[model samples]
Target: MKIARREAWTGRVLLLVLMAATLMPFLSLLVTALHPSGSYPLGLEWPDDPQWGNFATAFTAARMTELLKSSVLIVLGVVPISLVVATMAGFAIGHLRIPGRRFVFLAFALGLTLPFEGIITPLYYLVRDMGVLNTRWAIILPLIGLFMPFSVFWMRAHFVNMPEELSESARIDGAGTWQLFWRVHVPLAAPATSSLAILLFLWTWNQFLLAIVLVDDPLQRTMSGALGAFQGQWGTDIPLLCAGSLLILTPTLTVFLIFQRRFVTALLQGSLKG
Candidate 1:
C-alpha cells in the first residue's frame, strides 16, 4: 500500500510538470503582451504598466473586425456543409451493404493523405475561373472539400463502431435508412459530431496557407491571413503582434475549453472501440 501511494504521488507530480511545460509558451506570451512598451532595464519584467490598449491597437490596425467576420462566414458555410455531406457519406459507407463500398471507403480515406499544396495550382485556376479568387467563398468552398475527408473518415469510424443490432432493431420497427440515420445514429453520434466540429473549426480558423494562396483582398481574408498582413505592416510591434495572435486564438480556445470534456470522452471512446 505504501509503495502504491508513493507511485501515485510521483505520477501526479510528473503530470503537473508536463502540464506546466505545455502551458509555458502561452503564459510567456500573455506576460509579454501585457508588458508595457518601456517598462524594464532592457524592456523585460512583470509589466510595471500593463498595456491593455495593445489589444485595441492590434484590432484596429489589423482590421480584425472584418477579418473576424470573414472567418465566421467561412466557418458557418463550411462546417454545416462538411458535416452534412460527410455524415451522409459516412452513413452510406459504414452502414449500407452496397457494392464497391470498400473501394469508396478507401478512396475517401485517401483524401486524408492528400496535401493542399499538391492541389493548390489546379484549385487556384478553378477558383479563378469561377471568379472567386479574392472572395470569401474561395476559401469556404475549398475548406469544405478539404475538411470532408477527415470528417467522413471520423464519422464512418464512429458509425461502424455502433452495434449492428441498433440498426437491425430500428429496421424491424419499420424505420427506413434515412430515418435510422437521422433519428437514431445521428443523435447517438453527438459526441463524435461535436468533437469533429471543434477540430474543423480549429482547422478552418487557423488556416493560413489556403487563405494566403486563395485570398488577396485584405477585407476578404480570415484572421490568420489578416495576421500575416498585420505582421507585414507592423513587424516590429511585438506587443501588437502578440495581442493579435491572442485575439485570433480566443474563439478556437473558447470552443475547445467549452467542449473539452466531450472531446476527450469521444476521442477516448472512439480509440477504445477502434
Candidate 2:
C-alpha cells in the first residue's frame, strides 16, 4: 500500500512537471505578445500595462482577416468531404470485408508511411499540370488526398472494433449496406467520427508546407502558411508575431477545449467497445 501510494504521488508530480514544461513557452509567448508593441518584451515577465493593441496590429498587419477566411474555407472543404470518403472506405474495408481487404488496407497503411516531404516535389508538378498552380484548389485537392490514409485508418479502427451483433442485428432487420452505414452504424460511430473530424480539422487548419509551396498568394494560403511570408515581412515585430500566431491557434484551441471530452470519449469508446 505504501509503495503504491508513493508511486501515485511520483507519477502525479512527474505529470505536473511535464505539463509546466510544455506550457511555459506558450505562457512566455502570451506575455511577450501582450507587452507594449514598441518595448522589447523578453523573458516571462508580465508587462505592467498589457498591449491589447498588439492583437489589432497583428490582425491588420498580418492580414489575418483574409488568412483566417482562407483557412476556414479550406477546413470547411476538407473536413466534411474527407470524413465522408474515409467513413465509406473504412466501413467497406472494415465492416464489409470485401475481396482483397488486406491488400486495400495494406495500401492505405503504406500511404501512412509515405511522408509529405517525399512526394511534395512530384505533387507540385502534378498540381501544376492540373492547372491549379496558385489557386485555392491547389491547397484543397492535395490536402484531401493526403488526409485520406490516416482518416481511413482511424475510422476503420473504430468500425472494425465495433461489435458484430450491431451489424448482424441491423442486417436481420433488412438493413442494406448504405442503410446500415447511414441509419444504424453512424449513430453508434458518432464518437469516432467526432474525433476524426477534430483531427482532420487540426491537420487542415495548420497545413503549412503544402499551402506555402502550392499557393504563393498569402491570401490564398492557410493561416499557418501565410504566417511564413507574413513573418518575413514582420519578423522583427515580436509582439505582433506572437499575437498573430495565437489568433491562428484560437479556433483550434477553442474546438479542442469545447470538444475535448468527445475526443477522449472517442478513444475510450474505441478501446472499451473493442
Candidate 3:
C-alpha cells in the first residue's frame, strides 16, 4: 500500500510539472499581449492597463478574414482527398492483401522518412512548372502528397489490426469488395477515422513552412503562414505580434478541445489493438 501511494504521488507530481511546462509559454504570450502594443515588457510582467484592443488591431492589420478563407479552402482541398485516398490505399494494402502489398507498403513507409524541408526545393520548382505556384493549390496539393505516407500508415494500422473474422463473415454474406469495405469495415473504423481527421485538420491548419514556401501570396497562405508577413511588418510591435499569434492559434485550440475525447478514445483503441 505504501509503495502504491508513493508511486501515485510521484505520478501526480510529474503530471503537474508537465502541465505547467505546457502552459507556461502560452501564459507568457497572453501576458505579453496584454501589454501596450510596441512596448517590450520584460517576461511575464502584467501591465497596469491591459490593451485588449490589440487583438482587433492585429486582426484588421493582418487581414485575418482573407487568411481564414484561404486556410479553409486549402484544408477543404487537402483533408477530404487525403482521407479518401489514404483510406482506400490502406484498405487495399492492409485488409485485402493485394499482390505487391509488401512493396507498396514499403514505398509508403519510405515516404515517412522523407522530410518536407528536404523536398521543398524540388517541390517548389515542380509547382512553378505546373503554373500553380501562387495559387491555393500550391499549398493544397503538396500537403495532400506530403500527408499521404503518415495518413496511409495510420489508416493501415487500424485496418491491419481489425479482426479477420469480420471480413470472413461479410464475405459469407455475399458482400462485394466495395460493400465489404464501405458497409462492414468503414463503420467500425469510425473512431480511428475521426481521430485521423482531427489530426489532419490540425496539421493542415498549423502548416507554416509549406504554406509560406509554396504560395507567394500572403493572402493565399494559411493563417500561421501569414505570420511571417505579419511579423515582417510588425515584428517590433511585440504585444500586437503576440495578439495576432494568439488569434491564429485559437481555432486549432478550439478544435482540439472539442474533439479531445474522441482523439483520446482513438489513441486508446489503437494502443489496445497493438
Candidate 4:
C-alpha cells in the first residue's frame, strides 16, 4: 500500500509537470497578447492596462470574416471528397479480390511518402495549365489528393480487421457489392470514418503551405495566409499577431473539443473491437 501510494504521488507530480510544460507557451502568448503596444513595459510586472482590443484590430486587419469563409468552404469541399475517395479505395483494397490488389494498395500507400514540396512546383504548372490557379478548387483538389493516402491506409486497416463474416453474410443475403459496401461495410466502419473525418478536417483547416503557394490574391486566401498578410502590415504589433494566431487556432481547437469524446470512443472501438 505504501509503494502504491508513492507511485500515485509520482504519477501526479509527473502529470503536473507535463501540464505546465505544455501550457507555458500558450500562457506566454496570452501574456504577450495582453501587453501594451509600442514596447514591453519596463520591469517584469503584469501590464497595468492589457490591450484586449488587439484582437479586434487583428480581426479587422486580417479580414478574418472573409478568410474564415474561404477556409470553411475549402474544408467543406475537401473533407467529403477525401473521405469518399479514401473510403472507396480502402474498401476495395481490403475486400475486393482483384488481381494485383497488393500492388495497387502499395501504389496508393506510396502517396504517403511523396512530400508536397517535391510536387508543388509541378502541381503549380499543372494547375496553371488547367487554368485553375488562384481558384478555391486549386487548393481543394490538391488537398484531397494529398490527404487521401493516409485516409485510405487507415480505413483499409480498419476494414481488413473487421469480421469477414459480416461481409460474407451480407453477400449471402443477395446484396450486390455496392449495396454491401454502402449499406453494410460503410455503416460498420463508422468509427474509422469518424476518426478519419476529424483528422481530415483538422489537416484541411490548418493547411498553410498549399494555401500560400496556390493562392495569390489575399481575398481568396485562408485564415493562415491572411494572417501572413496581417503580419506584413503590422509586424511590430506582437499582440495583434498573437491575437490573430489565437483566432486562427480557434476552429480546430473547438472542433476537437466538441468531438473529442466521440473521437476517443470511436478510436478505441475501432482499434479494439474491429
Report the lDDT tens digits of candidate 2 across residue range 1-274: 9999999999999999999998887888899999877567769999899898899899888878788889989998899999999999999899888999999999999999989999999999999999999988999999999999999999899888777898899899998889999998888788888999999998888899999899999999998899899789878878878888888888888999999999998888777866
Runs in model 1 deviating more than 4 A are 37-44
Taken over the whole model, the C-alpha lDDT of each candidate is 0.85, 0.90, 0.94, 0.83
lDDT of 1 by residue, 1-274 (tens): 9999999999999999999998877776677788654332233356777889988888888888888889998889888889889888888888775789899889888998999999999999999999988899999999998998899899899888788899999999999988999999999989888889889888998888888888988678778877788888877767777788888888888988898998999999998989
Q: What pairs collide in candidate 1?
A: none
lDDT of 3 by residue, 148-176 (tens): 99999999999998888999998999999
Q: Which of the predicted structures, 2 or 3, would earn the higher TM-score when compared with the native?
A: 3
Best by lDDT: 3
In terms of lDDT, the poorest run of 10 residues in model 3 is 208-217
lDDT for position 93 in model 3 = 92
| Count of backbone clashes, every candidate in sequence | 0, 0, 0, 0
Please report how far candidate 1 places residue 270 from its true position, in Å: 0.4
CA deviation > 4 Å runs, candidate 3: none
Per-model TM-score versus the true fold: 0.93, 0.95, 0.98, 0.92
What are the root-mean-square deviations of the candidates from the true structure over C-alphas? 2.0, 1.4, 0.9, 2.0
Question: Which order, best to worst by TM-score?
Answer: 3, 2, 1, 4
Model 4's C-alpha root-mean-square deviation from the true structure amounts to: 2.0
Predicted candidate 4 versus true structure: per-residue lDDT over 1-274, tens digit per residue: 9999999999999999999998776777777777776555333346778889878877887888999899889888999988998889888887775688799889878989999899999999988998989988889989888898898888888777767788789899999999998999898888788889999989888887888898887667667766667778777877778777888988888999999988998778766855
